[model samples]
Target chain A: MTSSTTEPIKITSKEQAEWFLNQYDTFLFDCDGVLWLGTHLLPRTKEILNYLTELGKKLIFVTNNSTKSRLTYTKKFASFGINVTEDQIFTSGYASAVYVRDFLKLQPGKDKIWIFGEAGIGEELATMGFESLGGIDTRLDEPFDATTSPFLQNGLDDDVKCVIAGLDTKVNYHRLAITLQYLRKTESVHFVGTNVDSTFPQKGMILPGAGSMVESIATSSGRRPSYCGKPNANMLNTIISAKNLERSKCCMVGDRLNTDMKFGVEGKLGGTLLVLSGIETEERALEINEAYPRPKYYIDTLGDIFDLTH
Target chain B: MTSSTTEPIKITSKEQAEWFLNQYDTFLFDCDGVLWLGTHLLPRTKEILNYLTELGKKLIFVTNNSTKSRLTYTKKFASFGINVTEDQIFTSGYASAVYVRDFLKLQPGKDKIWIFGEAGIGEELATMGFESLGGIDTRLDEPFDATTSPFLQNGLDDDVKCVIAGLDTKVNYHRLAITLQYLRKTESVHFVGTNVDSTFPQKGMILPGAGSMVESIATSSGRRPSYCGKPNANMLNTIISAKNLERSKCCMVGDRLNTDMKFGVEGKLGGTLLVLSGIETEERALEINEAYPRPKYYIDTLGDIFDLTH
Candidate 1:
């Protein structure tokens, strides 16, 4: 655990590829880094996904991205010339809706959730016919007298039973203020964050992610959310129960160890693979093992593995 | 200390008030509760200040509110018929400017400070001819696409040597984004907060304060500001150097324990007074001592001691 893959067998030839390809029936892949960087899809990514599909492997795209819905993800994959179904895509946003609906049993009319994210979260929550408040165009951005002793004219609703925070660009102070107010009213309001990625990738730039935005409310409220994304094992429950896949026959493929690899190891999946197409590097991955458990396999990029499939 | 002050001297009798009033010549007062509760000036507040003035005691009003400048504060006192001069007032905003200009040595001509509060913080910094970018009227509140991967089209100014965050009502995501971009640059850029109050007093409701706003920036940048208000010794240095008084001859009087009482103890002032006119009560004060050092003196209210003088 304190070092990177200790002499990991690199899949160089078709014989070596057949070893792992035959062993696992289910493959969970982290998008963004392993498949594409920003909008530019990586070379051989579509081909590898097709190759995996040809073998009748159950493929699921596990993304930490809470800004886009599963339908948007499906359209995005289609634009990339790879037809991805909604069932095969498991975004953190969709999982968050699942957490609120089925897991917590928040019925359509009885309960409401206060969202602190963008359209992705709103779209997913809408799918379950759940009502939400405090996203964009909610007009929480109206300027008030920047006074210390503010007058109370606003009324509170008793129906809000959950406060969910995700990657929000329009996250203003009022969203945080209202979220804290809901949590302070009662202990029953469950707090859930989509994911806690410290920083997220954009086009040639990295910005502060959901974890950075969520810390204020967490600190102010003196309560931490039950995170429903990667680094938490609950995200895989949907796939595990749906496929009835054995732990020994599942493998996780991701570019980072903390979220992707950690998810697999913590969830008790069969194996883990680390690719160096995104944030982590070959040298940095060795140092990272000191903190998180080492991944089972390491490769330079997804492009490096397609040669073994031949 | 791990315990509260056991058997704190309660200033009930005239003899008790005469003791500390005769011993300490330097008196520091916290504004919110000791003098007035919200907009209502407490009974006998003006009489006590006038009485202290007749006794030749040097007095200064220290406030953690950053929404107003020292000039505005002097005007506020005048409106209350107190006739207090500008020199008798020191706000957290004024202290923040002093921190950057005098303490951190951020030169006006060469270096600039980025502000994330209101006009109050900007006015104080401007008094010293220090230019700061960002704050109210910055137009960061304007709507943009709440996208996950926002492209970086804006360039950063390298002249900003210090970033000061206060209780901003207009705080948006861009302010947090720009501040992090500045801090992420060089280690030379300093981060400063007016005060770290988690929540502050409003009319009927308590809202998220400066501490809540500053946290995301502090957490994201991984750099803490040189805080310039209560519980910090720097506020005392302003009074100590100006009045040429020893710490042992000074006393701090306020309604709150954490900010006011801790300010006195941490600054090594001669005495500390806690008034139950505001947040704390007899029962709560006793329990608070378990975590923080108890104040040396306790009274029902400052109005109680004014009766002793009468």
Candidate 2:
């Protein structure tokens, strides 16, 4: 059996760490649960930020939760006692919007959206300057009363360019019916989902997250949503491009093994820290580590950053 | 517009009627919304039944909704003024149970199950003599407690002989989480969904149905349930066996184009009747007919059965 040592273990042996540190210039972190869960920042999170800042390490907060815009995350981080700008925050929502706009060659103002999500997701679409027909305030116009709203009805027309899924509590029987209807009409219409998480902690209770909602729509519509989140190639590509960092130079830290650790594995990030303060448990960590793309380090909490650097 | 008299109606003419009558000896009908939606039978449903019985046509009722057993359906149909034996009712639940028993090659009582959905679904497994868990009354055991009961939490488990989806309102957060967890662990586990319906008419209001539940589980589990309903091969197989008839000698008559018409196309049934009484609207029928699987006849209702026979 391996020795049960109290000493904080390095992600790599000293020689390996020195070798990796020598090659890597930038680091990416997953917010929510890693930096903080909701409003509660992880202990010593600020110290890690200061240490990274002093080391001149470029840091980017990559989040799959696209229910909030970068501006909102940036502002929220400030409230959590961390100073960050919008440029440092990368969201799958924004990445997806950009991807759809560029790859599909969609004109910014020309494509119409039938979005089913929160304001943050809507804002990201707007930032790309795309016209959307289904938002929180988008009216239930003529031929689509409350009962006929795509949110309420059976089918949406072929003219709909995209169908986006984010966080929407107001999602009712109608939206689902319409989504399936529209999805059946045009398979070419893009189906985008913010994340695949089934539930998220909200106000002390876990609420049905965007994933369940996205799955519902996908199942009903018989269309798979192009997931734009961690572990997805698109989000990883965005991080690589935006940070100007090589894959081998980056490290991802997070509480969820399936999301954060999977991202690190798929992206070929140099290192990953599996913190136990959020979703995955110690048992889950061990199970995950047995697989490929295992995390480089296992920390009881985010405070282990002090032991690693100091 | 062309004159109606000039068009000569172009309906199911006398020659077409004779062709249909001579072609089929066995008929398989779906119960819900096809023969009767809820407790109310469709118009001329009794007349069609009487006519088929008078002609000595072999008939079997197949339903994907597994909330009730064959016996329950037999009783329900009897109350609706149609006589049916338990042997005449075939359910997806029974098909799934048989599939599990055969695939595992397990002796009758050896296999264990962690079932989700209704009593009918569970009863099918029980009938196969499988030791089952995760029913409504099944105790919340350790490690598989309320927080982890795949059925009440998500849908079903991998250890289960089969994870069946029929109809259940208890589909909530806990069920989803556990179902996903079990699915991730075992790929060999079979997924069975009763139907692919989006919504079912309930208490005069359309309600989220089993299809939506199955879809949610499928999305998270990353496995598609082998559907055992209308248009699927299993129902056709069951119909063939139950009626002791060749596939070429069977005709499916129903109200919806997708379900009824697809059955004819795929099952190679002699004829199909697109009845306007239940699900498919006239406009939808026109669009569906243009698709690969087209209906053989369009009827105002089951009352048109007499017109064909005469």
Best-fitting candidate, scored by DockQ: 1
Compared with the true structure, what per-residue lDDT tens digits does model 1 show for residues A127-202?
8898888766456655543332121245566788898888887777677776677777788999998987867766
DockQ of each: 0.50, 0.16
B37 Cα displacement, candidate 2 (Å): 5.7
Q: Which parts of model 1 have CA positions greater than 4 angstroms off? A: A1-18, A144-154, B2-4, B143-154, B288-290
Residues B124-180, model 1: lDDT tens digits:
888889887877754565653224313224466778898899888777777777777
The whole-model lDDT of each prediction reads 0.80, 0.67
- Name every residue pair that clashes in candidate 1: A149-B202, B4-B289
Per-residue lDDT, model 2, residue B306, is 63
**True lDDT of residue A302, candidate 1:** 77
lDDT of 2 by residue, B1-310 (tens): 1111111111356676566666788777767767887777777788878887888888877776777878788889889888888887888777666666654454556556655676777787777677766545434222234444435456443346556666565443444545555555577666777777666654345555678877777765667888777667777776576457777777676665566667666777766656676776766655433333545666566656666666
- Estimate candidate 2's alpha-carbon lDDT, on a 0 to 1 scale: 0.67
Backbone steric clashes in candidate 1, count: 2
